[model samples]
Target: MQKGKIGVSSDNLFPIIKKFLYSDHEIFLREIVSNAVDATQKLKTLASVGEYKGELGDLTIRVSIDKKKKTLTVSDAGVGMTSEEIDKYINQIAFSGANEFVEKYKNDAQAIIGHFGLGFYSSFMVSKKVEVITRSYKDEAEGVKWECDGSPEFELTNVKKERRGTDIIMYIDDDNKEFLEDYRVEELLKKYCKFLPVEIAFGKKKEWKEDKQVDTDEDNIINDTKPAWTKAPADLKDEDYLKFYKQLYPMADDPLFNIHLNVDYPFNLTGILYFPKLKKNIEVQKNKIQLYSNQVFVTDSVEGVVPEFLTLLHGVIDSPDIPLNVSRSYLQSDSNVKKISSHITKKVADRLNEIFKNDRKQFEEKWDDLKIFIEYGMITEEKFYERAEKFVLLKNTEGKYFTLEEYKNIIKDNQTDKDKQLVYLYATDVDAQFTFIEAAKNKGYDVLQMDGQLDSHFINHLESKLKDSRFVRVDGDVVEKLIPKDEKQEMKLSEGDRLDLTPVFHGQLPQRGKANFLVTFEAMSENDSPVLITQNEFMRRMKDMAEMQGGMSFYGDMPDNYNLVINANHPLVMRINEDKEKDLEKDLKGMKSKISTLDKRRAELEKAKEGKKDEEVPSAEKEELHDVSNKLDELKKKKETLLNEYGQKNKLVKQLIDLALLSNNMLKGEDLNKFVKRSIELI
Candidate 1:
């Protein structure tokens, strides 16, 4: 195979570099400011190494805007370039002097991010013309002036400069004159350079004077040179972290906890992540984690950099190991990124574990706020789930918290089902599900309050991870069926009696749009409420997940189905049965006999014609069978009408159904008003 060198044409190079060097035009400001930081850091490195024997004056980098001229300038008090140095580095594209300087002074120049060489060209992304005035730190080396427009042409000349630093001035292009506005430039500086190592000054500090704001001589320093994350853990106090958290999120509720990550062995990473008081909207909490490199703010969107669950946290992470330019594919494949992500997950888990072990009470106090983050982590990351299981807490309606294992031990003997699966009963809302919660509590079973936004998904995740343990909402079933240690209680009514009594309770159900009710009879203890409403666990779970996640609209779109369970053994229910028998006993017996006769004949005819095809069956037999089926339907309808008429006059039936519906927070409007009036009349 023949090989040849890839060539880049001079004519296309300038435009390509300006248009595609960075993603956004606003990034030009970040690039120029970062280059200034690199130069300032280089000067500090020289002074430390004894190569530059000169007093290092104030190393502040200043950003200023000239709106009238539509120009932007960044000035730094750091190592400047000589005429030849400018020719070698500036004239050549993608050759940063900071790289060479950092390599030579690698031990002392830890702060140098090594971006100035090529990043300088990024200024052209938003500028029609650019000028560089720089003076060498070496004595008697002449100052140099370099200027370039949007083309591949440049001018260099000798220039008088007093400062031993660089000043990059850009004539803002018409399309990007927004950069010339003082507020816009200041906003960019704060976004990208707020945590930089060197002080960055944007404008004069403003003070309130005579009810108006006026500029003062004091510089408006835009960044905190020594941010909390850059310092050693021993040097920081709790208050220091709190102050940093406030700086990051001014209006957020105080965080539940903070994880200060400082790692250097596998990869350089430093950050302070705070677990904020998360709301129901997970989307709103994301993109709060900021990513940085050597204190230069890179981006607030850190999804690819951190574990997905950790993005829910609010904080800053700075690592030179994580490349300045991060893309999804690059981050997913990069070894350094993988290491950093793993390390951060471990740090978060470790911090949570430490707090739990040292201060149990405090951990419980913050459980509500910390729960969503922990649950989200446990759901998304296997390693995180493994670690979190040790500290993740379960809170009950009694307001007590326990670890998964502890909760299992506390409820095992009472909650283990006939299938030997442990049951974890929970409620979404303490007030809304109060009756069910109390029902479980009355039976000496603990009811967990899983009310957080992600708790629905978290419950599903826990079921998969825990050993044969299932989480059932308190309202998922009656107490006996929820755990099911014993076989289901047989309904007290007979097969015929059950069918005859269905209409008694079913007929009184109020019309609820998109809601379906199935009348069920359960032989519960007389002490229990006569009627109770319960939703099936699996169907409810699908609907809950559909609301939180995508691709499950089938379940969400299905009409709500609830079991209106009639406690057959309850005194009031037995009394309703007695009253129904008194009113419809003669009519029910006559209907039952006729129904049996028709059903028996229908079954006989169906069996006789089973082997015979439809065409072989005689027309007389088909007509006789059809008449029997019609008679069955007519007899059933008459029986139902008789039971319904009896139920209409029975206030107890209405009150019991109303009580069950009200307990579920489902009774409303005219039905509720009628229930109150009927209850008063009965009293």
Candidate 2:
């Protein structure tokens, strides 16, 4: 027997290994199993090169858990380490045996997974003690047993062994007894080794006998050895890809389509990227893309490996170039990772364009599901936006689709405004905004359905991309104002009449929760609705953007601003104006005359004092001007009070205001009830 300390600069190595070597102690299983696989693959390489004259029997790795013994063992039938080899590799900390072997057999060795020497020490994270019983393949070699008990001190001695392989036995600590559970071991194997290059057996296969599961004689192998991503795209059919997608995500709906990524040039990257049917809640679908290193599952959080928008996609991405154990910041800053991300973005754009150019009907059929991803890409990645513009589509309220250029051409002749800017009319809800949509269509304009969760941000992106183009909601303004021409019409009511009518409409406005409406007059045809409600495109868009993005919460905090546009030419509005003049004519005329006299005197006093020093102006004149201003304000208040009183008495005024509120989906609860009763009385 020989006793020695592990090669380390400090005596606190074991503590560091247990607490800081790995982010999660569960990864110890992955590290040990991966090492076993490396040994098995090395044995195959040696046999092929005639370096070892032995039978290459079954190379399956076995993992067994013994609850009674409180030990978990991972055994492999492969090239095992001799005493001298163990002394050099195991005793010397941070010395990777796989790295040495690969250096020696660089031409013949297959891909090795371990590059860092710290993987073996990860076993100490969950073990109270660990033992390595190994027998080298060399002729006339004896088996060696190595043991360590949570310390730098280790024991090595000769032992009898029949097989040419290695066995790693971990005596699980009391704190980590869960590792002794069969189901837990099986689950770890299935997660990390499901697609490994070597077959891994956890325990015996089970069978349902008399409604109870029983162990069978067969081995329960948990790995595929060769997944679909490792094969060529030519060998896979569409159904095969879909089958693999189901294997990855059993509960998810069938993906809209897939992109078979098989690139070997810039960096070795292979996987199938499925375009899943994403929901409006983007956070729920994020981190679904699993990233693997040489077929071993590394992580499902692949934010840095792919573009931010492409993270919405679901599938597996296996690449040997990505480091298995590194910070996300390092992965994001690595040049190769950036190249891989760029390549993936390009491939996705290319595939969509191919589908669109070859079979546009199919593309259109899938557009509703595909729009969210494309819009996200366009809003986030500039390169993706440039490539995706050709395939990005806009669907009208009539269920017809068109590309950006195609829609522009169709509407350029009529939708172009007086400033030569083309207006793109869109509606959030076709049914809810049916009146506005019909008005737009009546004016020979098309209205698109911009109802996606990300449409607000996407519209702003398109405005920047499309030249001389602007997007306007169908309910954003009146149909004529949405695409205004050079011709202007005069309002039927004078400014004074309009101001007087403002109080009448304002008095009848409902108490909508956190909503503010401004009464305004527009000259329209008598056939139009007497009153219509519209929102400003910019403010509404800002509020919508604030809902999706940060740093714009101030916009969301503001109340929704709406315009109550009263068409002066409409019969109801004209009648209301006539009624207002008849009811408040006596009181309004008296107040107006008084206010006019006070205003004239104040203006003369101000003109008399112009360009004079403060001392040169008379104090009595200043006091008189102040009185005149106060009297003018009081007369205006009296006029407003009389108009509001008249407006409250007039049932027609409340009916018109309620009609406008109902059109905007804002009339509800007690206000809606009152409006209904008032509407019945008026009828």
Candidate 3:
């Protein structure tokens, strides 16, 4: 027997490894199994290189849990370490400063992950004592047994003859006795070794015999050894990718399509990214992109390695260049990782462009599923947008799909207004905004379907990118004003008449929550819609953006203001004016007399104080002016009250307002029911 202290500068090594080396206690199993795999792979390499002249026997790595013994053993058939190698690799902790090492690599679960040659030490996290029985492949090497009891000290001695391999045995501690359970060990193996290249044997396979299930003699292998991503794309069919998707996410919906990535020169990267059938809630589908290093599972949260927009995709990204650590800091600084990200972006854009050019019908078939992803990429990645601009599609209300340039060319002649601004008409809902859509269509113009999860943000981005282009929702304005085919028509109604009608309509506006209405009269042609509801584009966009993002919540809390545009050229609007003139002519005459007298007195008082400072002006003149202003305010109130009374008694006013509200889909619940009943009663 030989004895010596561990090769380390400090005696507090065990405490450091126990408390801070790994982020999760669950990772102990992955480390040990990874070490066993490394050993098995090394033996295979040695045998292939003529270093060993022995039978390349079974290369399986076995995991066994002994309940009564409270021990979990990971045994591998590979190049095991001899006594001297054990002393150097196991006994010697080749670390400079434990604190600095832990701090530098703490965030990265992969940095200290398979490093430290201390894959064996991770056992100390869950074990009270760990024993290693290893036999080197060398002809004259003696089998050795090394044991440690969660301390710096260790015992080494000769052991009985065994195969040329190593068996790591761990005695589960009181706090971690759960590792001794069969199901727990099985779950850990499935999590960390499900796609490992080597064969991992957890336990004997079972079969359902006549009366009950029976354990068979066959060893239960937990991993695939060769996942679909590692194979050639030519060998995989569409169903194969779907099958692999089901294997990765059994409960998820079938993916729309997949992009097989196999690049070597710039940076070695191979994986299958699936365009998941992303439902409405985009937040729940994140973190599904698993990151791996040489088939060893690293993490699923690959925010730093992948471009921000690409995070919306679901699949696996396996690269040796990416760091293997809980903290992904290593990848954040790796030049290779940056190149890999750029390559991935290029590949995704290339695939989309190819799909758009080759099978546009299929692309259109899946546009709803693909729109959000394309929009996100365009909004976030500048380079991606450059490539995507050619293939990004727009489906108009006519159900025809056109690329950005295609749609621009088709509409350039007709959609460009007198100011040379290219107007892009769009509708959030084709059915709800059907009236507006039809109006725009009737003008020989196209209206796009902008109903999407990210369309609001996408339109904002598009407007910024496309020069002289403006995205106008179909319902944003009246048909003529939407494209501004000719200069805006002047309002024919007199200013006094507008003021008189404004109060009448304003008093009858809806009393819904935070719902304010602005009454505007447009001299649209008689053929145009009698009434239109237009929301301010800026305020509406702010609220839509606020729903998706934070810090703009003030806009979300503000009232929803809409324009109650009454077409003055329409017959109903003209009749409303005629009725108002006949009903309020007498009241208007009396109010005008009172208001004119007050205004004359106020003008005389103001003239007395003109060109004079407050100290120079007489208090009597100021008091007289104030009295006149009060009388004017009283007369205005009387006029407003009379207008409200006229509006209340007029059915044309209520009928027109309700019809406009119904057209905009703003009348809901009780209001909608009342509108239906009112329509019946009027008919």
Candidate 4:
């Protein structure tokens, strides 16, 4: 028998191991099972190198729970430890007094025991006492037993055992009695060891015989010794990858495609990344990609390992180089992690490029489902953007797909303005912007559907990337100004005529939710609608962006700015302007002539005061100017009121405004009903 305090540099090592070394106490099962697998792997490696010349017997790691005894046992027929090895490896935790180790990680408890190659100590987390019965795989080796009762002291002694293996028995603490449950242990095994390279068995296979279930002689193996990712890519088919994806996500829809990542040089990394059929919501699809270390499941939250934008992908990423237990910050800054991230990005880009080049029809068919990923990548990662631009597709409103370069080539000759800037017109809603889209189509221009959830931010990113190019919403402005195909048409109406006729349409503008309408006139073809509404691109994009990202909520709070543009050359608009002048000219004439005289006097006073200081200007002249300004403002208001009354009486004014609103799908409820009733009578 051997009795001695476990050789530890710190007296509080046990407390630190049990309380601070693991973030989740339940992960102790993962650590212990992982260690068993590691041992099994080591034995396999030795046999491959011809170091061990004995029969390579069954190597299944077994996990059993004894309910009555309140103990959980994990046994492995692998490279078992001798007494000397137990003393040297298991007892010694650190070379230093380890005060620095304690001090450095005293406050932070996220550090896992497995991180320091001390995974066995994690068993102490849930155990009141742990027993290890191990015998080395040697001809004359004797079995040995080591026992510890959640303290620095441990007892080791030789024991009789016929088998060459190790068995770890953990006496569950009173507070952790749940570990003794068969269901609990099975769940932990499936979570942590589901895809381990070595076989893992829990309990025994059962058969429904007689009236109920009965245990069979066959072992109930729980793990897939060879998951699909561990195999060579050439050995896997499309169906195999899809089947694995389904295995990972039983309830999810089939993935669009997958990229098999297998790289050994510089760092060992192997896994399958599936491009899931993402929905409009980006957050719901995150955390689907699980990270593994040498087939041991580490974390599904792989934000720091994979790029943040790539977390939407589903499946597994196993890399032996990545540390099993690491702080997110540490993982983000680690050089190996950075290399792995870049490699993954390159692999993804290459895969996408291959698909796009080989099967363009398939790529186009899947473009809608695939664009969100490409767009998000382009928006977040610069290198991804550089690579993705080669295969990135732009979908048009007519349901056609074109690569960025292809679309640019098609539109550069037609959509480029005199300023030499290529205009990429897009629409959010095809049905709502149907008129604008048709107008653009008629002008030999194309419109894209930028309806994805990420499109707002992606549009901003593309504008910055594409040289001398801009993205305009199809309804962002009048068609003439949107592309400026020809020299801008001169406004047919004078400024005074436009100002005098503005109140006619302004008075009839219907109230919509948080909508601000500015009545303006522009010259257009006589065939064009007399009135149409268009939103400013910059203001609308700011509001749309505010909805996607949270920082610019003030833009969201602001009213939507719509320009109620009147086609001055159209017959209806011309008639309306002429009628407004004919009806209100006599009434406003007297007030206008008096206002003109007052304005001229006020202008003379403003010019007189321009070069002079405020105090130097005569007080009598200031009073005359102030009086003239007040009278002119009063006269203008009265003239505007008369014109407003005329417009309210003219049903044509209300009908024109409603027609423009209806064309834009903004007319609703009672206003639509009145427009319908008035349209019948006017017809």
Highest TM-score among the candidates is held by which one? 3
Alpha-carbon lDDT, every model: 0.82, 0.85, 0.83, 0.84
Model 1 C-alpha lDDT per residue in residues 184-282, reported as the tens digit of each score? 888888888888889999889999999999999999999999999988999999999999999988887888888888888978788889888876666
- In candidate 2, the residue pairs with backbone N, CA or C atoms under 3 Å apart (3 or more residues apart, or in different chains) clash, namely none
Off by over 4 Å in 1: 1-8, 94-115, 208-214, 326-333, 487-491, 596-630
Worst 10 residues of 4 by lDDT: 324-333
Q: Write the per-residue lDDT of candidate 4 for residues 73-165, one digit (tens) a residue.
A: 999998888898898778766634444665655344235433323678878889999999999887799999999997889899999988888
TM-score against truth, every candidate: 0.91, 0.92, 0.93, 0.92
lDDT of 1 at 280: 60
Which regions of candidate 3 deviate over 4 angstroms?
A: 100-116, 325-332, 488-492, 590-632
- Backbone Cα, N, C clashes tallied per candidate: 1, 0, 11, 0
- RMSD of each candidate relative to the true structure: 5.2, 3.8, 2.9, 3.5
- What local lDDT does model 4 show for residue 556? 90
Which runs in model 2 stand beyond 4 Å of their true positions? 94-117, 326-332, 588-631
Give the higher-TM-score candidate: 3 or 4.
3
